[model samples]
Target: MIIESYSFGRMKVDGIGFDSDLIIFPEKIVSSWWRVQGHYLQVRDLGEVLDYQPEVLVIGTGYSGCMDVADEVKKELEAAGIKYYIEKSSRAVEIFNKIDSKKKVGAFHLTC
Candidate 1:
């Protein structure tokens, strides 16, 4: 899928706009995604992406990077051998645009 645009609290992917947290998979977009702790991220919040077995997982930690990705979550991803990245939304968008993995996923927190 192609990300057409991204701005505070919103993003456009493959011609569809999303105003909430979302998971972008190679073949589909999961909208209205919510985390267990609102602004905190955990492995349990990413069950769908994990089950997809992506080659890479890029995390967008919100517009101003307010969301916190837990250490234990990182450890779990590492254990699963999934290459992952955590960055502020803007930077993460750049990284996501550059990746060419056949099986890649992105979990994006649209706003802070």
Candidate 2:
């Protein structure tokens, strides 16, 4: 899917807009994704992504980078041989859009 644009609390992907957090996979978009810990990311929060077995995973830590990715999550991704990039939502959007979505997935946090 192509991300047409991104702004505070909003994102347009393939002509559709999403106002809540979402996971973008090659096959479909999972909307309104919520983590067990609101501002922290853990391995358990990435079950779907892990199952997808993407070559790359991009994480958007919210509009202002309020969210933090836990170290354990990093270790797990590395162990699984999944390359990943963590950035604020805006930059993450750029990275996601530039990649080949066929082997990539993105988890985005729309708001702080």
Candidate 3:
């Protein structure tokens, strides 16, 4: 999926607008994604992404980078051989758009 644009609490993906947090996979988009602990990103929060076995994972940690990605999550992704990028939502949008991998997934927190 192509992420067309991203703002504070909204994102445009594949020409469609979504106001909720989302996970963008190669073949589909999962909307309204909520973490188990709200602003904290745990490994459990990424079950779907892990199951998909993407070569790369991109995380957008809200507009002001309010979200926290657990270190265990990073280590697990590393153990699974998954490359990852973590950044504030706006910059994450830029990074996501530049990547050319089909086996890539993006989980984004749209708001702070």
Candidate 4:
């Protein structure tokens, strides 16, 4: 589903522009306890929103980029048979768009 617009606490996301600290693709109702910047938060939030655990989770860490994917989260995903790709914001967007369009995968992207 196309996300027309959304506002979450200090974050604001719209199709045309973003006024948020982050943007979650394929926007949908989210659980309140899911924290955006918290450690291991992306996987938790995406799991809540998508309703189904994914085979892969791609994380776009902020501008400077972060290579460390939390070991615990990685273990959980791996145990659940989920692969992960962690990269900078720009590359994450490209990868997400490609997989989303081709395989109809579900993705949650957060960017600054």
User: Which candidate comes out best when scored by TM-score?
Assistant: 3
- Writing each residue's lDDT as its tens digit, candidate 3 over 9-83 gives 999999999999999998899999999999999999999999999999999999999999999999999999999
Q: Clashing residue pairs in candidate 3, if any?
A: none
Per-residue lDDT for 1-112 in model 1, tens only?
Answer: 7678889999999899999999999888999999999999988999998888888999999999999999998998999899999999999998998999889899999998
Go through the candidates in order and give the clash count of each. 0, 0, 0, 0
Where is model 4 poorest over a 10-residue stretch in terms of lDDT?
A: 101-110
Query: Global lDDT of each model?
Result: 0.92, 0.94, 0.95, 0.46
Between prediction 1 and prediction 4, which has the larger lDDT?
Answer: 1
**Which residue runs does candidate 4 get wrong by more than 4 Å?**
1-16, 21-51, 66-68, 100-112
Query: How many clashing pairs in candidate 3?
Result: 0
lDDT of 4 by residue, 1-112 (tens): 3334333222232334443334343444232332456534444545542445555555655444533355666677777776666666556555555565321232333433
Residue 66, candidate 3: C-alpha displacement in angstroms: 0.3
**Residue 14 in candidate 3, Cα distance off native in Å:** 0.5
Pairs in clash, predicted candidate 1: none
What's the residue-level lDDT of 72 in candidate 2? 95
If scored against the real structure, what TM-score would every candidate get?
0.97, 0.97, 0.98, 0.55
Model 2 scores what on Cα lDDT?
A: 0.94
Top lDDT model? 3
Candidate 1 Cα outliers beyond 4 Å, as residue runs: none
Question: Candidate 2, residue 86: CA error in Å?
Answer: 0.0
